[model samples]
Target: MFLPDVHAEPDTEVLFQFIKENPLGLLITGINSTSVDFLQCTHAPFVLDLPNAGDNTTPRLRAHVAKQNPQVKAMIETLDTKPSETITLDQEVLVLFNGRHDHYVTPKFYTETKPDTGKVVPTWNYSAVQIYGKLSLYYDSKTPETGAFLGKQMHDLSEQCERSVMGFTGDGDRPQPWKVSDAPERYVELLQRNVVGIEIEIRKVEGKFKMSQEMRPGDREGVVKGVSRALTQVGVTCMGIHLYVPRQ
Candidate 1:
């Protein structure tokens, strides 16, 4: 939650694009203020309802969790307090998405600038985005509105994951993307009974990319080489990666 200005990214479209690439998010909820379960975190892959590049409308996040998941209970309880005249901060939830290209920087990587001062230390280089929002839950596909909402979420989420994560094009020579309609209506209905749909009206979003850019050019190159060499040994490619400290 602490974001330093030098590390902060003011361009939201860039941040949203990062989420589109890395759609799995860690959902955070602070439920009962005085209870042990106050801080709740859940991990799930979500599809974003991002608006056009220049639109002023707020974006949203859509995902579903198992009906029996403990986090569901927490979210349901939070939504129940909307009638209160004074809205509390606990009602807002956070979804954190981290970029894929991240690595650790060791003092050893400071080949060019180190060995002179012997003052370098180890730090992590990573990129992350935090999104805060008020979430609404849909319990079932029983009503017209609820049915449409649940159905669209399932279908769209499936297609998006297929196209984005699975590399299915749903056209051309690539493999065809799958959709919720691929299954029997009754089967889909049966599955829906065991889960709850979640929609978050995003209130705020912030991205931090801490990649050791603050260091000298020589040190930055050293980090890239160190990470790339380490990853190459493990059959991974980590050529260029950057992350930032928290902002002001």
Candidate 2:
């Protein structure tokens, strides 16, 4: 997470939006930092809950995994914790969101404008957000809160994804969004029972948008054009500010 001040997004609001836009985050965890022998990486949809004004609660991200997942088993074993009850891992983990915005820029895009006459090399333009935090698992509920957290997490995550799939701005061709309640209650409950809920107590969040802002104006435009052609996005919000480079 090497965040340059020039590309950092300090505004929590923008970062939150970015997370929402990219829910399929990569969860990376390991048994110990000393070796990569037991490293586990998973990509899953996560729901972020931001603290409200005056609220003392810190931000948290929630997701779920099948009970059979090796990563889940390894985490439980590493912490010597039972999966039947709520448990938190002492080791911190990382979650990364790429937001489906990335592109390759060739030298041809910058040769004309760069100061070094046609000396520019190929590079990548992309945006990424990283979350560092301790992870907690909610399995069979030992308490009311723990038991209900799984259901709520599933419901909220499903609703958000449904909205995204159905189009927030409203698409005439799309049907009504789906919900957890749409399925038979017994079936939904049965499926939920076979999975485990997870929550991350976010200790820090970092955003990096490398959209060629460091390039000269003309070279920058060349980069943006390539990005625009690839991603259809001319503007991207840096972690705190906005980078008006289009990654077509």
Candidate 3:
């Protein structure tokens, strides 16, 4: 999360939007004295639990994941050995959500288009966000509560997915659409057995939007147009594609 001033995004709205758009996150933690224990999780859009009046310093995050996932096992193992290391109900963790990115930026796109004198090399532009917070893991004693939480999380995720992808027409609006109760008992039991609820308290957030912000206006415009055309040729849309436009 080394965010240079040129690419730093301090706006909270922008950071939240990035997280909402990219719900899938990479949860990294040090395990077994190594820094490589990472879990790629499709996290449900979680709420930041903030203190009301007196307690404003500590913030927490809330989400859930499958209990059967290996990351949970790793966490449990870590907790068992080092109880002190276990993330408390309000301990912050780092959550990283990455957006679409690709290589293959050609210098010709900017250099040839712009009236530049010096030579220019290829570069790539992308966006990403790092959220630091504590997490809370929740478990239900009764099947009803478990079903309710799981159902709500799943429904929210499905709605997000549908809204993001175009041409989705599956139960967009319903007061009581597809509840866990609609499914068979066995399915609900299976979900209850496998799912693990998660909550994270975010203390700080860092966002990097490296979308040709360092380039001159003309150079940036050229790059945007070039990248857009190139991506379209390959049937893709890249970051900052909408930012480039020809002036009258």
Candidate 4:
């Protein structure tokens, strides 16, 4: 991920919060040094669980993918392979969550502060988190244990979104939050059969907040104002973006 020390975010809370806000993570597998053809990727929604987080516990991510997904087959192959003298059955994968709006900044944005410098170039501003974990695939989604797990995953993910900026909550004017049980039981059961559950025991996590933290103070504010005006023109609010200002 090429995370520099200057832009690195080492806080566990911040990483977890980013995953919660951006649950639709990209699951990447089959990262072999030999060939790129073996690589696989799947876009899936996830539920972050940090049960023992206070004690420096590693987080567990829960999500489900269609049974017919090619990535599912690749992971199962890893599980079925027996460890020999040089091989092991363990499969590690990456899940990437892109959490915020990314916009391009032009040199013109910094021209006011550095009129003759000509130092600023085009760059992008964004926030993202990368999670690396060992894959644990559950094939029996219909069993009581797996079914319960899937149910909880569905509930937690939907409820979290209900309370998010793009979602609705039953306040005075908004409609009530929706639930998984709102669907017909028979239909839900049929739908469940086509998917398999995935649980990731996270081994490591990294966060990158590239919000012009390295730029000069005046140039930083100028870039922010330029992007804000552009976003507002398109009816998009920019209140939630966290700004990074140098400490005095």
Candidate 5:
């Protein structure tokens, strides 16, 4: 995450939009002690609780993981020392969301398009966001609260994904989107036993958008058209080709 000042993206709106579009984030956890090299990483779909633009409240990431996951066991082990603490707020973790589209840029694209510009070189165009926060695990291995918490995560996650694609219409003619409540109550109860809920309260978020903004004017436009054409050929919708130039 070595973000140069030129590459840094401070736009909060763009950052959240990127996260919503790419909800599947990689979660990395490390122990509190400096001597420990133990690190746990998991990939899960996260639902963001992003407050209003001017609001000062911290954002949170909500998601769940399988109960059998080793990271779950690792967190439980780490929290054993503080039995009274239901939520482990002291442990910071990292969550990463990769951009939806990324492509390599060849100097040939620039050289051929702009024959006079020999200054162009190869580069990569991509977008990425890194979130740092304290992870709060919400499952008491022995209590009913565990099932309830896990169930809520499942329900919310399902609805989020469904709504993004196509929400339930309640019409008999069209096939209804699947929901957590659609499953049998007993089956859901049993299903919840196999997973646990987690939430990360975000302390910091950073976005890096490298889309040839630093290149010469001719070279920059060449990249956009070249990348767009290449993406269309492969049947992929181009996501972000950021060309925002920061004021000097």
Candidate 6:
């Protein structure tokens, strides 16, 4: 969260795209100031309500998980407390979405650069986003409206998943792939009974892209090339933002 000006990502679109690409996130909240706990869940990308088209206001995140998950019980207990006059929801909760990262930048990549010439060193590069917000929790079957909302949320996520997987299939005589609707009434009932939905009303969003942006152009280019050729998983990490080289 301590993002320096050099690494700050002010572009909301870029931050949102990063979150969409990496949906699994950690939801963190506190029962009191000292009792902070984390809940991990996979989020479904939803439209973030913005006051204006270009506003930098934090965007809301939507996600759901099974009722059996311990996090659900912990959250419900936290919500039961009476609202305090001093601390509002805006100051309480935080969600973190981490993307692909690696540790392959070697000092050799920057040791022969122009600006530093012979004094530069190596550093790891990565991307991540942190969102601070209010939370709204919904349990299905608690009320008619909430039940319907849960059903709709599940249906929407199902469609999103299907689109991601089915779009690649070439035309053939094969039957359409399985959809959420294909499930029997009992299965739907079971899902409805077991699922809990969470809505995070974001107040602040912070993005960090530590992709050698601070290094001299020559040093950065060398790091990128070296990382690209490395056989470790870090190769893909460098390759992804290779085109997003630092601005002079």
Top-TM-score candidate index = 1
Worst 10 residues of 3 by lDDT: 82-91
Error of 2 at 115 (Å): 7.6
Candidate 3 residue lDDT tens string, 1-248: 77788788888767877776677777654444232255434444554444667975665555667765666665665553432232353234678788766445566666544445656767777779888766655455144655565566656555555555433554456243344456787876676657666756677888988776666666776767777788788887565354522222
Off by over 4 Å in 1: 33-36, 53-56, 77-90, 239-248
| Ten contiguous residues minimizing lDDT sum, candidate 6 | 82-91
Question: Residue 229's C-alpha lDDT in candidate 5?
Answer: 84
What lDDT is obtained when candidate 5 is compared to the true structure? Answer: 0.78
RMSD of each: 4.2, 5.0, 5.4, 4.2, 3.6, 5.1
Query: Tens-digit lDDT track for model 4 on 1-248?
Result: 87876677888897998888778899997744332348889998888888763677667998888977877666554444431111222767899999658888887777455686776688888888999988766666556767777777777877877767455788878888888899898887887777777888898999988888888777888888888888889999987655686434
Clashes (backbone N, CA, C under 3 Å), per candidate, total 12, 12, 18, 0, 0, 0
Please give each candidate's TM-score: 0.87, 0.84, 0.72, 0.86, 0.83, 0.76
Candidate 5 local lDDT, 44-126, one digit each (tens): 99999988879988899999888778777777765655432346746789999998778899886673445875766677878
**By lDDT, highest first, what's the ranking?**
1, 5, 2, 4, 6, 3
Q: Which lDDT values do the candidates have, in the order given?
A: 0.79, 0.78, 0.61, 0.76, 0.78, 0.64
Candidate 1 local distance difference test against the native: 0.79
TM-score winner between candidates 3 and 5: 5
- Give the residue spans of candidate 4 off by over 4 A: 31-37, 53-57, 81-89, 165-167
Cα lDDT for residue 123, candidate 3: 75
Task: Please identify model 5 stretches exceeding 4 Å from their true place.
Answer: 32-37, 52-56, 81-85, 111-114, 141-145, 166-175, 235-248
In model 1, state the lDDT of residue 146.
Answer: 56
Give the candidate number with the greatest lDDT.
Answer: 1
Off by over 4 Å in 2: 32-37, 111-116, 141-143, 168-174, 229-248
Give one digit per residue, the lDDT tens place, for model 2 in 48-77: 998988999999999998877778777767
As a TM-score, model 2 comes out at 0.84
